[model samples]
Target: MLKKIFKQTIQINQIPKYFLASPKPNFPIDKIRNFNIIAHIDHGKSTLADRILEMTGTIVKGEQYLDKLQVEKERGITVKAQTAAMTYEYKGEKYLLNLIDTPGHVDFHYEVSRSMRSCSGSLLLVDACQGIQAQTLSNYEKAKDNGLKIIPVINKIDMPAAHPEEVAENMQLQFDVEKEDIHFISAKTGVGVDGVLRAVVEKLDPPKADINKPFKGFLIDSWFIKDQGVVMLVQVKDGCIAKGEQIMSCAFKKRYDIFEVGILNPEMTPQNSLTAGQVGYIFTNMKAVSDARVGDTFHKPDEEVEPEQGFQEARPMVFAGLYPDDPEDYMQLEKSIYKLALTDPAVHIYKESSAALGNGFRCGFLGLLHMDVFKQRLDDEYNLDCFLTTPSVPYRAKLRNSQKILEVENALMAPDDGLVEHYEEPLAEATILCPKEYVSAVMNLADERRGEQKEINIVDEKRFKLKYTFPLSEIITDFFDKLKSATQGYASLDYYHSGFREAKIKKLVILLMGEPVDSLSFMVHERRAHDFGKNICKKLKEKLPGQQFTVAIQAKLGSKIIAREEIPALRKNVTAKCYGGDYSRKKKLLERQKEGKKNMRSIGRVQIGKDTFVDILKN
Candidate 1:
């Protein structure tokens, strides 16, 4: 009788609902130092992130907490963005520093902008010797367009030839940054890193959130933490939350709780409290990771705040049909893409039925960099076989004859040429920084690609800079390849979209065995199609092995195939190289050639590589 009474009494004790939602944004602007770190590739954005973590005592000294990816450190390039939080105490006041490190490569602008939206300031890093390349200016422009305050940082200043003062002057003059604000530091040596930290403490104000109300925060980034499920790194903008409280992200319509909440120290500190201006992690109890997408907003259930803007579903800029190289691995590839999409929502894949490629969804991306990264990620993360179309960035136009706007990725996808009245091509305005001697070669190469010389500015007696405007279509495929070759990798170019204009553009498709191979297609001005065709034919002919019949290779534009080359059959009684049971090797080579002909594209008696059919455009 006593046990029954006790159990009934315990059950009678009522359980209350756990509350997790965002309150109003009474966040005072003064306390929020919303900023991001932006730089060119190899300019040390991730390394700097590590230094800040160390200086702020966020992680233990000598611990390698940043760039946890082996490939990232091995390749010496940051393929993705990294976010971390730190606290700087000065003048008897503690300040929270929210750091969002962004990719410097051209491909990651979408994610970069998403993260940039959460900040009001940006740190622009310029290589002292490399000066400002295209990506540096592009990222700066992204932040500038978002109306963020910029602190120009001249990184790699420890190098003997680093010209930090000149870089500062160039920034002040070239980009109009304040002279006093350029910070010169070597993130590797930790030199001047403290100065940057002090500047952050001195310059930026921490975020002031409405702590009196329910919890609302910004979802900066998200990734799966293995056995822990999904971990969301967020900034509580205007609210508070306790452990076991459930939260909802208005954008993704996801509800999760504070499974564990705290700053991501070297090892996270489980905290009972987090306030506005705090940078920390919010782990959810959900087993499904897809719900915790990055760049979404989180709030308590009933307490509402102003809806964050730019959460609109991102329209993919480039679309390509994806397929597994090995058809047997198609299912494995499909599963891998889902896992990739969970991390990078921008690299999207949806089901589509194509007449040619069959049932495969068109994959979408932000740019060539995004496409390449997606392809690489699938290969690396899932170890699956996959292939994607050549990267293309869509453009908009209405015919001069008819003002109906047409949005397509390039000349290939644009409406027929006759319908294209006043169609505009994307142009990249570039500044090439290099030693004075390479200026002519760089300028010449640009000209060869139909680039218009905008201006030539002298950087110094030993160095010079040239500005050029080229269609984005031209640069997307091979501009970097050519520029790097001509300059021997010494020249660095910076690019920015210079708007669209009426320009001559054409897509050249190279045909082997009368069938177009996707690999050989490229965008070129109509004027250079003939020479480009010849160069391509030459390159292909050099690569192809000897065969029994003539091989015809040509470049086609729509229905017109131009400049066909026919390779004659290898003549003469072929001498067999035979030594130590290898005597029939040459005869066997002939037999293999004849067998390959059976597999090559005939196009009514012409022969081409069976393997080369789809790979012609890759070069």
Candidate 2:
């Protein structure tokens, strides 16, 4: 029966023999460790995971199996959190290690937070050379808040510039750990990694569980598969979940039969049952994309259990429009986005139509990196090309008559200036870690972006941490890139929404041929409205195709035009046929052509191609 089910689910050429025959091991709760590795980007979390997998005989040594997505391979970053189960014999006893490898980028903080919930401990990896970064600190705080036992592991100790001693000292101050508590290892070369593994077995507490209670679990993550509906990675908190069992989601309130229960030993290996303290995947009869909530709790249909405290839904911070280059691909793109959103729930998608770009979906993401990665995944995984518009943040508008507040995520959704009492923009508190030498540059960059310094602390003799609060709109666009540029790529930033503040902001509208383009309109501060209008008008003048008549590009604030530019009409010499004709005949031909151009300008509609928007949006 297992073989038959495997045959139905497997899309590959052939199913692996071991998947069909591998015996399930029922390890005791005390012998199991549920933990995750958390660190900043490029801090060697995946490398350390690979080493751990190899040492435990889960897979080959050089296989970077943690990051399975194509975008991850191309970008060399983990965009999603992945899990692996390993069997290791420590001393004379065997232990079951369930490890979740989390992304370090701040854009995926939701992923990190969700992964942390299923684990009882975390390996806080830090780079020896780069010291502590802003994300590292942020992740550390999350781990602390989750009540996870954190092990300070300093990686890349073998590098030429590596200062394990200094990094350890900084960790001591930041994390309040003793000298002996810190573990130094080079993840690349595998030096002292074995000791780190031993530390995991010894220091980290096993997950607290009781198999005698009713079956209960919460989904840590989930993804859709072609042949097999939705596969969920769940952490069983009590009792057990088995194949052919009827389970119901506490959140969705829908029942599903467990088609298969398995653990990813880096690969899907079927297990008879997943008990308390075990992290494994469940195959269900869920076909709808919305059926599998990422953090929903599940329980036996016959039992009444209190629902677990599931994760708070991720809120999108940045918004952008994603329209297919060809309108026919809209349905396909919509399907692809729904499928992708299963794995990434933070992206908020809604139907939006643009006057400039036509039919598309306006999507919201956590940050710029999240938006870029989502688009790249669409291209790489789904073979879909999308025309993306300028990213904007959600703004608040107040109606003057009723004093009702409106959330304006898309520029088209924003009300006219007269309809508002005032506008309030979202603010974010940014935490930056940088070398002291670049402090002045960082400060200047922050000041230029209307940031107010909140606090500055010296991390060490040569490094300091700067905290600033700025309008979320300011940092959502190229602020991190500019920060890196000013700090010579040595600065790391992490931020969180800091509520909304009133500001002198106005809606900047772009009109083409006397018609407003929804995609080109945006909200800007009153102080920078003129310059932004001028720049946008200039950019449109260059990218917009010339029409039969002169095309007027104008940026308007309320009733006043702040900036204007014009594109010359594509003209043809109507009088070319008469080389030696009378001057009056030539003059009459010119006047007729001019009248035709004028009539065309008044009646004709300009069509902006996908390439034009792409060029204008490119940085």
Candidate 3:
């Protein structure tokens, strides 16, 4: 009878006192602050977040989480956005601190932005010594537009050449914010963490919500554990929410019987009714997670209307053509993509038919890093082994006579010579901010990759802004790697698609022996046709096995195969002493290798081994 009474006492909407500190009848929501820690990759966002979490006493002292998952800790970057509930006692009243930690990489920009929508303020972390980079400014602008009050925090204060003053100065000169507004802290050493915590509680106060009415909560994130069933991490905005009842996800209006409503101390604990300015988890009967999305809302059983535009569908900005390395794994590949889509809805895939590669699909993303993460997720999470073709931007073209609109990703899909009257390729307005001594080096590097100088502004004698128009196709290629190399990693660059422009580009196919190797084909500008073919052939030559007969490689324009090379034949008489066995056995082993080489289809005299395509498309 006592056990039954205790179990029944914790209602569906009941939240524990720890998760949501119960307010008196007159308490207001203005004492709360909801914000996120954001920045470019390796800008100390995660370390700083740890400091805040430690300082606020949400987690114990000297108990660093390393983040919530293995992947996040191993990569040293935030893979997803996570919200933690913390309380700060300052000036007598306890202020609630709800902090969201986000990924700094550009690939997860949508996730970062979506998380930002829930935050009323953002702590913009920047590396003190490295100064500001491209992604830093981009996320900063996004947080600003989301109505998030900006608190610039110059991280890594303990570094040898720490430049808190320089980064502050750069923030003032570049982004047009007051230098005095930013905060400097070493989340690593827990330096100045108190100031950060106090500032968050004092300066960035919360938005108002009426708690006297019925409950309305926002589901910031939801997941399914193998053994635990379905779980939701939610933020209660108004009134009170209870467990043991049915609730609906505002994004889909899908209902679930609330099994339990609780707090997460790295684990969920049953609690009572959750009220305004609170964060907690809810276990529900809905298992598939088809109804919920990040940034979704949860409401009382009766509310009908959803958010105006529906849940904003995240669209991938970068697209890459993908193929199963071994055609037999097609079913495996399909299942892998579908499973990954469960957690990451942004990875979009569509069926594609290519003349060279045949049946395949095009995967879309926000950027190259986004594409890399998706592909890596397939390999790491889903265990799908596949080969990727060289990535290229979708090109827009029209037929000369019929004027048919065509979007081309694979070079082989590009129409014949006379068919294309005009083609427009995507262009990016790129910005490179760097020191004056490296400005010439950056400019030369940009020029080498076919960038047109748009403008150049001298910020100071030592700092300058170099603007350029670059092809999106170039960006997906090795352009970024080259920029990093040329600038000695000093130049900070950022580029966004401006629009499409007329392009003088053509498809260049690499032929092994006399037949084309489909995956090696790429779109190359008129002047770069030879260079593109040469680079691919050079990499392929190193990867392909040696053959009995001379193997030739050539650059082809469809039916016309031009520019050729040959891998010289194997020696008729190899050294007998090299092998332990007799000459005949050594000859047989060599003969087997030669047979394997012959079995592979050759473009002319060039033979491509089975492993020729691995990491060929990667940097």
Candidate 4:
């Protein structure tokens, strides 16, 4: 039954002939070098890639082709993993180089992992000024685990404070790489970049795969294009795949007739077939976005081969409710989210409805930046205005009566206190790198976030690495910003899921004028509930406008109030018309005014404007 559905394909004649060019002359697989560039954020990975592209003439000068996303350009960071295939003549022989530029931010670690899986080696770039950082170590470990050869390179050698020799020694001591293998280059000035590229051709081993074997490739990344349908980036592991060939996904067990095969020369260039040890793209003419999943293996339909191992599913660390700014745009928002999810399978979305927010999706992300990028994409690509609730982490709750466990992604989905037997919150192991001078500030900040010190290692006299275990919930909100501010933007952080631990947690609920507001509620540690409640109530008090009747704002844990604040009512001149009347008439007017105030207190509904919600979230 599934085979029939998987057999669907678009007619081959519909695609342009330019997108299905003739097969190239067979080249020895030994001449191909598939590698990726990895480093800590702001360590010049993208800059190095630009230089490589220029030196090889794959992209013309003054062309911005790799960092195509607007967000990446605006922030000067690489968020997406992009591939560029270049042909360079080295040592009097033509060699094919497949270079994948990966994201450095921890939020996009999954993207880096995928890029690593497709490569035979990696260029481990480090900033000469900053030395080794948290992500540099993290990415090194990832490369090592993949059994890929790592070539350490020191970047920014032209800077005034450049310390290439010192950084090379540190890399040798920390990573155990020989000093002779370290390459120093200035990507900004194109100095020594030629040596780095030459080293790649000489040092990195060519991809070892048999061309005679049945066709098998791993899908490293996938996204949807308007007319192209689902375009998948694939790394050929064994044999060859050609246009119009029948292929099947080992993970989804779905079949597809390849509509097009191409290579990214910083732009999509058509190719008839991709043999073993090659990296390129394949269009399956798949209409559904969910059909092409990252990390899935594709092979010939007749041959049944085991899928590649080491594919880790992306787990969302932060969850939040996303609603349309206008209630009437619910359907439009849903469609937009679906479209966005097609491109970003890391984002988990499900239908959710709220009394205050109307229809929305409970979306999950890798971290705060991941959520922000997803929201930004929705606005930029779909032109949809969205309202995002405060981000929260997933918590495990046990029902008191049935002992049934529930995964609570949103605070609103949490079971009532009476129904919950106990709760366990997720914890993470964080590794922080900072200069020795700011060690005290980083430690103090970690302690304030309820982080427990596990170990501290002095990398050198000037820098150190500290390991701490923290509640994932605590660090998901404003912790990264605080860490940066505390260290003057010199600290770097990398973390992974540790496990779940029992926590003394309480649901902090906010009530406005005797009515509970679900949007303002949160789950906080019991010890910090009072402080959090007080802070939130104070913020709300300052944001809410004065009304005719006094507005009571209270934060409660179950039935007990932890903090309370009141917004004073606006004063009205109700007795001014009685200037010429007797004292008895004035007294009557005062009585009427007092009676109206009493009635208003009981019936007035506190209206929370959109701007007020935005302000509260920003605070």
Of the two candidates 1 and 3, the one with more favorable TM-score, higher being better, is 3
lDDT per residue (tens digit) for residues 394-486 in model 2: 888878978589998876787878789989999998899999999999999999999999999999998999999999988988898999999
Reference-based TM-score of each model: 0.73, 0.88, 0.76, 0.89
Return the top candidate by TM-score.
Answer: 4
Q: Is candidate 1 or candidate 3 better by lDDT?
A: 3
What digit string (tens of lDDT, one per residue) describes model 4 on residues 460-529? 8789999999999889879989999999998999987778998987788999987889888788898889
Local error of candidate 3 at residue 508 (angstroms): 3.2
Q: What do the candidate models score in CA lDDT, each in turn?
A: 0.67, 0.85, 0.70, 0.85
Task: Kindly give the number of clashing pairs for every candidate.
Answer: 26, 0, 28, 0
Q: Is candidate 3 or candidate 4 better by lDDT?
A: 4
Per-residue lDDT value at 578 in model 4: 68
Which RMSD values do the candidates have, in order? 12.8, 7.5, 10.0, 8.8
Worst 10 residues of 3 by lDDT: 10-19
Candidate 3 per-residue lDDT over residues 397-431, each given as its tens digit:
77887858798755657887678887788888787
Error of 4 at 531 (Å): 1.8
Candidate 4: TM-score? 0.89
lDDT, residue 430, model 4: 91
